[model samples]
Target: MNLHSTPPRSGAVLAALAGAQFTVMLATSIVNVALPQIRVGVGLSDGGTTWVVNAYGLAFGALLLAGGRAADLLGRRRVLMAGLGLFAVASLTAGLAGSSDVLIAARAAQGVGAAAIAPAALALAMGLFPSGAGRGRALGVWGAVSGAGGAGGVLLGGVLTQAWGWPWIFHSVAFGTVLVLAAVAALIPRASSAEGGKFDLLGTVTITVSLTCLVWGLTTARGSGWTDPGVLGALLGSTVLLGAFVVIERRRSDALVPPRLFRTGRVAAGNLLMALLGSVWIALFFFLPLYQQQVLGMGPLATGAGQLPLAAANMLGASLAPRVSRRIGDSATVIAALLTTAAGMLWLARISADGSYVGHVLGPSILIGLGLSTAFVQLTALAVGGVPPQDAGLAGGLVNTTRQVGGAIGLAALATLAGTVTTHAAVTRTPQLEAVTAGYRAAFTVSAAVLTAAALLALLLTRRSGWQRTVATAPARRSAEPRASAVS
Candidate 1:
């Protein structure tokens, strides 16, 4: 309520923002754990079942930037609140749905709401906190959600699906949305729309079409083939659309994604790392649940509980990352984090149907969670730290854009890998549970390899002479004046 306070009630705003983020994340995991029930309930074949997840992901990934720009045009608080409202409506629709088509449509709506909310929430945080330890700490907490909230969802979803039913996942979302909506309403400050610029309708349409086509093609290519006409056409269309987007933006005086930001080595490298690391992050969170339920024969509640350690460790790692960066520099900290995460993924690949949770799952979960949190915090800091105030929303959008897009691509690729492995294992035995376990292991191996490559890339990103300072100190300095005003 006190607008003149030096801190600008950031803690309250963050709590509200994080609540929104947590609910969305919770929905994602809860639904994933209940996928089997939904598949059967809706009579979906294997190919059709994947759309349950992809529908949301495609919509969310495609529209993220447009959402951010919407925030600047519409007012961050307004767009965020609207997003929560839409999310609540979608949750209700999803909960009450009687068919797969309805469910997928509801999920797509949920994704659209998430696309609107996520960037606005993040941009508001940056706006409220600006520079220094305050912003770093805030981003650190946000980074932990990428791990902690994910872990919690697994546990919660498992219990809901096991004890109640699959529909309970949507029910849970509805309840959480009500709470988040109220909290955001009460806690978030009024934000004035900073719009005088024109919206890039063309860019938005092209990018959305491009990403949808690309992800759709990739997801389908697993069941079909790379040479499949639909896949080839989609891929080719995406490439062309992306090229057109580039050309359009270049011609525009105020483009959706300014080419100037790419000139900053830190921004470019951070976006790349966010995308690459997102691949590993998505695979670990998505598949690990399936691995536990399908291969390890764990019940939903037990599977969810099993992931708590990793979630807790992710929060711990986020808390520690800033200090690590302060001491060793961002480059070294990122390298160390990436390597640590890769090692954890490699260990995860050692899991078998016969393996014990303590011996196989626990340690790797902790390691991967820690690694992801550390890298995510650094990447976020690097992306939004320095730049003119006017470009903050765009910068934040780009950071998240890379992440969501990366996640879609990662899921598709990992799913394909897992499917191939499952098929190979089925060759040895019928398509039984044990065969599925082998496929899960193969997917884990690929996940490990992806993380290893990400680690190497993070090393390269940070090792550039100017990149380290950009990651560590520049954003804090760049936003100092505006932050001081916003806070004061």
Candidate 2:
């Protein structure tokens, strides 16, 4: 808890770190409910409007690895402050942007800042609380903030847009960024970077472009036909770039993501699980709001407000995760959390157009919420648990990159599937509302299936090679293993 043997302000340091995470996440999702006003103000076409969201996502997702590595080579604390400064500037620019393109560019700039901020912030937090109950509690707080940020964004988006205007959304984020910057500068201590090595510029460029292409292709595929020439070209280009990146990294002594990082099964497995969780997580956020507004005929504000239950439950579950992990081993905790969330998704799949929010949404939200945070907390620990200190920032970046990429890809696939289902239903002369509801049901059903599969994989992956070693506080692990014993 002390951050060091002599830190006098542990709470302040943690708060500063959490604020950084929350602000970046808030900036990401805060644009959702304000899109209508944003579109009108910027004179955006429907396609252009979607790009507002996609631009931020693209830049943020694609450059995350580079950002993470920057932290490693340049120092976590240094990169964090730099990122926050950029974020504040970008947010202010976005608030004052006069044209659609300018706004989009500003958002992309903000994404770049967020990419740097998120990984550095997490790495700093993990470094602060090295082990034991303190580490577990810190992760719990981190996960809870991560889970709540999106929901809070939606709620605030509506509130600000209605009470003030769309520009206020960006302004508010800018204000938050400044405040977090001050807190972090004052509270957090300086940390060392990787001792020596040139940054992997080649690997960075190739992987960044590869990810950008991949995410763009997926986003485009969801809107335009997958067979569209541009989409196909983007996908093909991404694959080629990715292959080249792999070959390049293997040759480089100073790789952006070293091949040896995956030597330990824990890092590999943790990332895979995070990807799976991210897929379901994206689908839930994307579909749930639309379900409330489109199917239930609620307004934007109402839809935003509806998410409160889920947000609250998610934070509570995050708070509870460490305690549960204390009782059950880390792997078991992940398995249980996945299964619990899967059950919630299945319950949600039973939704009807005629159903009320209480029956169709509220119950499932609570159940899913309980599972998501726990899984996220455990997966973070598993991914970075034993990574060498020099590679901690890179490890953080890699884990986050997988989650973002997985979410983008998964949302595209699920959305495509749902669109197909709705079209087919309409062809059969189904009611509009019913068809939409059925499509949502299909997405949730498939999500539940995916989560169940992930749970089984987590069990299998950990059983053969113990995962307890990766956890922060592996009290549930016995026989006085070194990693298990070191924490307590």
Candidate 3:
């Protein structure tokens, strides 16, 4: 399977790496679509249910940087294989779990596995492709995997949950992981480890603890209120731990994440866009199914079907990114994407209990999907675009960190909003269903507002005279070489 020097083999490598992304994304999406069923089956309370998704996100976000550094130190191939092994086993555990605790624990483990694999996979893709146009195309395909994952997960989750059971969704991940593991063994060439560094245990601990506490507080704050002692304690604890992490990194010879990486406009902008996108991204994932099942009275299958437009549009957008970027440049493309997404979110805010899916949901789905697809492709390109080849793993890891942290924060924020709205509406209820729908609408409005801000942020960062100008002025600008040169 060693295709180290052969250019054609790069395609095989991308396939293996992309397949890894596809499998992990599928596991989450399918789970998301089946949330209503899972709630009933696992006896998850409204507030507690968020953990079904958050557990994975929190672990993945917290551990991703460490995972990336580990890949650089241990060898990408070995780390990737180990991650696959852990993911497969965790999937099995999640599928077979008889209780909520077990399932959540398993999902968290799966997230850790995903965190490990993501950096290695991206770094390997970079190794196979190099920086330039070819790398951009490869990154285009890479971006597609992410969009496709979001869309496809709903469909897959729908079909599996409806036909089989929620457990089957987890089982399917296990099966897919096994296949991907085998495929990697058969397809991708072995890569030598890049230069290594000492393990940053203190930096790793500080980040993990800091992020966990922060996300926990945020997630819990909706029900507990910001002033709750528990919430305040977690937030304060997070700040102290994170502050220590920054200091620790400054003291370390080989820090987990170099402060210099933040100096690049693309890197910083990409991270911001990712966090904003993540917040909006996970909000939809968290809310849409609830809306469909609760407000629209859609069955699992029907709810899953409802998401078809979003998924299809996302894939379409991803496929079209290369052409769009070619015409408008990445900055313009990203700005357009973010604006479209914001507009869609605003439109979606108008959805009433009586609203039709095609009339209300379809257009927003298409716009949001397109926006995310475009933004994701360019953000990824920009994030990794400037890194030295040796720091490819770090670049990949850091970008992912932005995305996952955003996701965690978004879920917490939305869940809290939803809870507050529902509780308020409950007191004013004439009919229970109407009250619930009102709450959902309220949550959607807040989500739309959040996404609108995200759009502004994306616009500001990607503006020609703002961040893009910085990218243009950088000492070592990314060469706009064609994909063939970058990949070969």
Candidate 4:
């Protein structure tokens, strides 16, 4: 699973990896549509219902770096298998849970498994294909499936909740996990450990706790204000822990994340772009649904059905991204994609209370879906472009971590912004629907501006060669992968 080798079984390998990722993304979104049924089924309080989602996200985001590092150190195949087993067990437990506590705990366990699975899957995919066009095409397929997974979850959740029950959603994921686990075992070749020695312990613990505090603080800030004592305490605690992590990394030869990785301009710039794009991308999903349901009065099924066009366009754009990247280079293609996404956001900002779905939502959704997927694909590829074999897992984990963190920050801030706008509009004697629509529009406008800033920054970095212009192909660069180790 390295350069100059394409096994005949590559398709099966890709499917296994992609399916695992699909499950991870699907698990994140599906619960939203079924939340009501889930609440009644488990007798959850409002806070408990919210924690059902937050539990998964907090664990997923917090442990991702450690998961990726584990993949490298423990061996990708072993880690993926173990993760799938844990995911399957958790999914079943969640499906069978009769109490709120059990369900939330199981969801957190699922996230723990997902943190391991996501990085391991991506790292293995990278290993299957060589650098340049081969890897780009594989990544395109990865992007396509990932986008479809998220959209599909919304649709599937509604259907599952209506026809079967909320538990079926979790059950479905369990079934899929079992299928992919079998495929992975049969198809993927076993990988060797990155090195004989163990990974850094203190650094891992510090960073994991730091990230947990950061995500928890952000999650809490959505409901509680930023100035709330708990939120402030958690944020301050995270900052302190992060500082300790940096000091430990700098001093340790076997750092949890090698200090030199950040010095690579490609990794640095690419992840920065990822954070920016992910913020806007996540907010789009959140606000769009609220606009559809609350403003336009669409039911859950209709809302999910309406997103079919968006999902199709996303897959189409992802499929086309690799070819576009090859022709224009990664930086140029990413810049163009970002601009396209910004334009879509601006178009969506024109949403109105009285507007029809076909008239208002459809066109902007197609544009956003196409441009967002393309941008995500190219930027994701760019993030891992110059990394050596040993760093692949870390790179995979880093990109996913940034996306999750960005998504959390974006959703919380945008929700707060929307609420503030709605409150102001209501105070001014605007009608309820109109005021809410105004808030949605404001969110979209700000999202467009953020995307524009991302595009501008990418353009500036490309011109300055802060992003390695030839990193996409990587033929000229030496494979400077340092030896890494397994944690005991």
Candidate 5:
């Protein structure tokens, strides 16, 4: 289909695309609250349980570029449907898993599916809305959907795990996948495949291997010391592999990630900011539930309930972000969001064994949620800001890949740091509760610092001159065309 020439069915297309995006993102964090139950049910060790999360993230992060390029070469609708089917099947397999190995494998399979779905869905959404206010609004809704999915995953996982079993989380995802599949079939227009590009097999393989090795090394650092030969070897191998992949991409005629994309300052800055933001956000989800359950003696249901405010605030912030950006500009919005998030993380660093949920958790959650939601919308726009239409899927994949890879690395590093702190404090005869709280606090402090650094980088690296030029020209560009139909 000629996306620009077609009569806009914006509502149906946006709904279908956003639904697919939500389904894929939901799986990203759906198991956070159920990690404890899954560990017991599958007889997993602490290290093995971590893989339950990392395996999916690693595969998803590694394969996203390949998937995005494939969608460009193949038809987006065709690739999207195939991905949804694969996701549903993988969800079923995960739900039925009786061993950690099986569950991890299934989760990795789900990641492969998610890698395809995310970029295609994002590209399709971009295609549905023309540039200017319409595109900005659509992206805001897209960001809101993504935030809701991430936050809701925790709530839903807790509810399902409490009422049924850990397996129910996967089952619920499977059901949602089926519904989204039907929506895609009905609402998404079929497009002719773009032909003539050679797949970058060498680049794909090397990059995938490099990321896999990096995640494996990070994950192993917790069990074996960071200085362990195996961990050091894997990390070194990953660095070499990544260097090789970059070389291959430079040489390839049809590179998976076109090197020119990195030349744009906004694209580069946005991606770096996303990487830092994702690291802290994922670490928060991983550690906060443990704090509530282990330190505050909260049940799964209560923990889930406590997260509702965060989810709601995230949605509200996302909806308002685009409007805010119109007045303040995207860079200013991003900087403001990062500073707000950093402040929230700093507040959370004060958590004590005796801290109350309302006093400590609720306030920080609101700040972090609002910050994440607002930043996510603007960052996504910034990442893809000036890219050609043909490269939308590639841009989407790059942003998503950075987020997943950052999450995987961050979770592993923070988890290891927390474990080390807790272990040392215990060895020194500190009370267990106090020791764990100290570890959480230390992690939160680091997270705050990371956000502060990201804010500074945004200030330094974001191309203000180029962005201002685009904003200055947007009104003239939009005025020449007829008004596009509103999605809602």
Candidate 6:
């Protein structure tokens, strides 16, 4: 069942893997448009509602490294199938949940499944296509699928929520997961077992506990003050656990994540950039629906229609990213895309209580979508670039873990800032709409600043020399590679 010995049905393999990734991302974004309905239906308070999102992000981020290591040690295909089965069951549970608590728990279960599926799928794809032109093309397609899924979710969620109900969003993902499972079973070959090594149990437990505590602390801080005893305790606990994880990893031969992975500038910069991008990207989806539906008095359907341009633009950018990278180089392309996205955020920061979607939302959505999609393609390539094949799942997991963790933490911080701003405005007797708009604007402005900083960091940290080394070594490795002959 070693995929290395199987026939190379690269097209079919890529399609199956990308489809699985699409399902996971689509589930994440699909909830955004349905949040208002879910809140109302489940009788959730504002503080309780954020948990619906945070719970998933927390579980996904915290366990991703362990999930990746599991994929490596247990065999990627076996882990992937099990993950998909779990994801399907979780989605069904979510769809049937009648209370906020039940839904949140179900979502967290889904995250556990996603943590396994994401890294294993990426590792499988990487195994299918060796580094060189083939890897570049496969990554491009992968990026496009991710962008399309994320952007398309808003529209799809709106349509389903308006026509059927919010639960259909979960139902739809469940159905898609079933389809992906079938395709994956048919197309992807079984992976060989990794070389014998003990699982890093201490490292896994500490990292997972640390991230969960950290995200919980941040999310709780929005409702309870930062100085609240619970908040302080959780944050302190997270810090201690994280320190322990680092120490355990340094001492362990079979580390959950090899410390040496971060020594490469490409890996470090790529993950950092993705973390920053995820912070803003997730926040945008969370807030925009609220702005459109609550502030502008649009329906779910209208909001979905309004976001169609973003979906289209994201696909366009993803499609163009490989060519753009070829012309400008990966680092420059990423820098340019970040700057473009920052400008879009700045424009969005101008939103007002009386603003129209056409004037205030459309243009910026397109711009931001394009920038994010372009960056996604190159970032995906950069993340797995120059990594040995055996560690592919670990690398993928690390990149994705940063993104989800960054989203969880950043959203909490921005949500708190927005709430504080709105509360102060309310105390001063500002109009409710105006106060809310002010809060949203504040978040957008801060998001812009974050993206700008990411661009600067990418510029300083991503070295051309590292890319040259990858390119030079890639062909030599490919020359010694055996060709697989699977039927597509």
The C-alpha stretches of model 2 lying farther than 4 A from their native spots are 1-5, 191-194, 474-488
lDDT (tens digit, per residue) of candidate 6 on 65-112: 888888777777787888899999999999999998899999999999
Model 2 residue 265 distance off true place after TM-score fit, in angstroms = 0.8
lDDT of 2 by residue, 71-100 (tens): 878878788999999999999999999999
Q: Report model 4's TM-score to 2 decimal places.
A: 0.94
Report RMSD for candidate 5.
2.8
Task: Flag regions of model 4 displaced more than 4 Å.
Answer: 1-6, 192-194, 465-472, 476-488
**lDDT of candidate 4 vs native?**
0.84
Looking at model 5, residue 206 earns an lDDT score of 90
Q: Which stretches of candidate 6 lie over 4 Å from their true place?
A: 1-8, 464-488
| Model 3 stretches astray by more than 4 angstroms | 1-4, 39-48, 462-488
> Which is superior by lDDT, 1 or 5?
5
Better of 1 and 3 by lDDT: 1
Q: In model 1, which regions exceed 4 Å deviation?
A: 1-8, 428-434, 463-465, 470-479, 484-488
| lDDT values, one for every candidate | 0.79, 0.86, 0.76, 0.84, 0.83, 0.83
Please list the Cα RMSD from the true structure of every candidate, rounded to 1 decimal place. 2.3, 3.3, 3.2, 2.8, 2.8, 2.6
Task: Please give the TM-score that candidate 2 achieves against the real structure.
Answer: 0.95
Best by lDDT: 2
Per residue, candidate 4 scores C-alpha lDDT tens digits across 72-173 of 877887888899999999999999999999999999999999999999898888776646566677788888888888788788887888889999999999
**Residue 413 lDDT in model 5?**
84
lDDT of 3 by residue, 176-260 (tens): 9999899887776555334566888888888988988987788777667889999999999999998899889998888888776
Candidate 1, residues 288-400, lDDT tens digits: the string is 88878777778778888998999999999998888888788887788788888888888888887777788889999998889889988988888877655666666777787
lDDT of 2 at 15: 87
What overall lDDT, based on C-alpha atoms, would model 5 receive against the true structure?
0.83
